[model samples]
Target: MVTSLLTFLSLTAFPPAGDHYSSTDSGRVRLASELAWESGRLSGNQYALLTNSSSQRLFNLADSLIKTERAAVFFSPEHGFGTNLPDGVHSTDEQYKGRPVVSLYGNKKKPLTSDFGVADTLLIDIQEVGLRWYTYLSTIRYCLESAAMAGIPVIILDRPNPLGGLISEGPIPDSTLMSFVGALPVPVRYGLTVGELFTMAQHQNWFPLMKDLKLTVIRMDGWKRSMLWPSTGLDWIPPSPNLPTFQSLYWYSGTCLFEGTNLSEGRGTDLPFRWTGAPWLNPADSILFNQSGIRVQYDEKTPVSIPGRAHKPKYENERLPGFTMKSITGDRSVLQSIRQVILSLQSAGRPLTIKPYLFQLLGSRSVEETEEEMKALNDFRIESRLYHFYP
Candidate 1:
């Protein structure tokens, strides 16, 4: 394939990948001279793979490529072509700038390359929200698998995980609960950049063809371990519909648990996932609620101990008051503390009954069982620290 393309076109067009180039402190560089070699010799149909978060890199890379190569096919995820699709809006494929825009989301997720009829190289540049529950990761996994099967090389433009790269939380998904959402067994906060995550996935031999595929990761230049999302010096565009800010990212890893329950995950309000409520909660019940949303309930299954007081087992109503939304942070300390609050609510007799599909988000039943497993999580964290990608 490589030789045929070169034969069809002049051999001087494409530049070798090994040429080293450096960027300034901002990681921006002037276009290389070789890019001008093949200004306009071929038909325009090759594709650049990008999701909402990594879409910015598209223009940067395209500026250099269009100087020589033809225009590219663009692939998008759940938020649709331009990422303007609202929370649950149904999206359709369309054309932009004479190039076809393909939707990798909606009912069918696999790359419809056959449908497109002629896109060879698929460049992927999606932003991951750094949570297991987020759908973008699954979209990438599917794209990778399909691209490998079709013998397409994937170039991944890397970006930072907003929750930092040091911590891993939540439980690994069990085989039984696996879905598009939980494509692999990484923790809810598996702290690797999308490029590195693909590296780990390929190394583990998960996708057979993907293992041998030609994957090039354009890693972020100055990204460090402690630099949170705001520190990146880039604009913060929400990668998905509900995840608007870092606060939403923080509450999402835990509060996403609400998807399995009867209460609203705050979808209708300005703050989804971060502020949860039901019409059942009123000012009359506010006094019993805790700062972290846990309120005591009297049920019969589990009992509690106190000073001359054996409190009856109960369902604790977790009231997520407003402005606590502002307090959201996806830090390990914050996650662990939130985990304690959720498990405590579970131990208090409200054993969370998850939806069949949502079990993938929480990882597994082993992750859901309240009292014993939570303690095990602490132990797991210590052991998992060895796999830590960042400090």
Candidate 2:
């Protein structure tokens, strides 16, 4: 099969188009759309799909590009191929569209020598949840390393940050605790697309051995740094199971901290990150909780929601109501506010525990573990800069 496909490519002629391209009024172009149509990087076996909404864009482009005798491959991240797997599920090798579909999550987070031998160049198009802990971001870094090792060029088709590029939050991850979640010193809400992230990653010199890395980014035309996912005018496909709506991710950067606790983090419920709690939480008592100093650090609003109506009372209300968040003026203030709440809750013997440890979420205990570090955590939000894609 490989021999036959290789022969077809050897005899074909693919023309290169101009740098910029546009979409028609009614049509939605996928990430693979631009690169697939033109000839430069199509010769090698093509591969993509490691994160949320990434496969949608990749497959759309692959179907558009794959023609007579053209062979393309698609891969998946922490979730299995097609992202049918729930969060924390491992990926298994599979086949779809008559092409090889490999797993980039779980056992094979990083690419081995064999993956590169299958394709000459690789293309990455994933929808990241914008939080640092999400595995999708780590998958991208691993791909960069693999492509570098194999001497293959990687093209990233960027997408918008759902949290909006206007604001960034969180602290600089200590180098010692760097993991897939904290790939670099980036803030929790690093407001850049996968393409922009590639550029930043390069500048940060995180992968120094990947010196020969060949990368080209197909930047979005209609996107602006300030625009959130909804403003992009692109279809809203759930990038991950939990990120069902833009609102989910909008509140995730801070709310995700709940993951370290015994709290629900709203996973079993419909709202996931947006509606977080354990049975012990009294919506009435906790109503003004977020308004406090430490709680405010994690939530931008003085009051994250109205008390009794917080959960939307699964048995009664069907529609999820939202409350206005208090405008947070500074990151340090936000952190201070959140710490106050957490400590208060703990002292009150609230079911919440420090076990999951806030430090685990940051991928470091350095800043969150100590009073001085927590002070630094509050200041991390102020340092984050919004990314601008174009002039």
Each model's TM-score, in the order given? Answer: 0.72, 0.75
Per-residue error (Å), model 1, residue 41? 18
Name the regions of candidate 1 deviating beyond 4 angstroms. Answer: 1-21, 26-45, 57-69, 115-117, 282-323, 326-339, 346-354, 366-391
Give the C-alpha miss distance for residue 242 in model 1, angstroms: 2.1
Candidate 1 residue 280 Cα shift, in angstroms, is 2.9
lDDT of each: 0.57, 0.57
TM-score of 1: 0.72
- Give the distance in Å from residue 351's predicted Cα in candidate 1 to where it truly belongs: 11
Error of 2 at 27 (Å): 10
Error of 1 at 81 (Å): 1.2
Q: lDDT: which candidate is best?
A: 2
